[model samples]
Target: MITHIQGRLVEKNPTDVVIDCNGVGYLLNISLHTFSQIPDEESLKLFAYLIVREDSHTLYGFSSVAEREIFKLLISVNGIGASTARTMLSSITPQQVKEAIAHEDVALIQSIKGIGAKTAARVILDLKDKVLKVYDLDENEVSVNKNNTNKDEALSALEVLGFSKKQSERVLDKLLSEQPDANVETLIKDALKKL
Candidate 1:
């Protein structure tokens, strides 16, 4: 288990980086989020997780321990491999991943490029409690008002106004998450600007 690596950054790419630690240059797979956080010059440190299989040994690195923990949790779910976990992390920030699992927001999880509805639901079902516990988020933080119709109404209005359902839903979800008590009109207006 390579917990972390601290060394001079020899190479930097969107999906990977090479770090020169002592005399060895270690190549680490990284998500876009981590890639964005890494600087192009001098010394750097990344929290790392190594995966060993029958054929290959791979090392994935994250900009923060929190992201690494989320990656580990994501891969622990059945049917979610390291690559899928990386894709998930790459598709969204670690915090968003936590929020999706904690809130059981299947649609938000499914919106990721490779994840489907079933996988999204499975992720929520398998990890929601763990996410809550790991993040120290209580039920109150995870629970959304079941009677909240503002999001639904805003989505319907956006659809009627010719916005795509999926896009509208994503935008509306973001708006509602930012402003939980926003009215339909406010959501619609904010969503329109984002859409």
Candidate 2:
């Protein structure tokens, strides 16, 4: 089991990298997030997950153990494959993936390209509990999930008060990201000031 690779970075691209360990050069598939996280140094280390099929062996690399763990969870779903899991990791940060599942934010999950409504819902359904348990996330922390409700209410109120839904949602997303525990009233107040 090749758990990790530490070697000279022979080549790098948005979707893959080649690392020269000793005299052997190994190519590992990677997500954009991992590609960005990789430092510009000769000596680099990446945690790896190996997928072996009857026809070929593929190696995927992650910048962190957390990202790799999420990839495993994502691929465990009935319809999600390694490529789909990599796409999910590339589309959003690992923390965002965990929060989305824990909070049941189907829209956020569906926002990724190639992910439809059903697949997004399935991701949340299949991994929500596992994510919660593995990450030790209690309601108090994912209170950000609560923010989704509060944020929706705040957006609705703003729309009724003549603000554009698109603009209101943009401002609300920023506000919620900054203050995850803010209530609907607070979100409205802050968003109103910003808008």
lDDT of 2 by residue, 1-195 (tens): 999999999999999999999999999999999999999999999999999999999999999999999999999999999999999999999999998999988768877999986898899889988998999989677654666757767877998999997899999999988888888899999999999
> Model-by-model lDDT, in order?
0.86, 0.91
Worst 10 residues of 1 by lDDT: 144-153
Candidate 1 local lDDT, 1-195, one digit each (tens): 689999999999989999999989999999999999997669999999999999999999999999999999999999999989989999999999998788776656877888976798799889988988878998886667431446656766887899998888888777777778888888888988898
C-alpha RMSD of each candidate structure in angstroms: 5.2, 4.9
What lDDT does model 2 reach?
Answer: 0.91
Residue 147 CA displacement from its true place in model 2, Å: 7.2
Lowest lDDT sum, 10 consecutive residues, model 2, at 140-149
- lDDT of model 1, residue 97: 95
* Cα error of candidate 2 at position 65, Å: 0.8
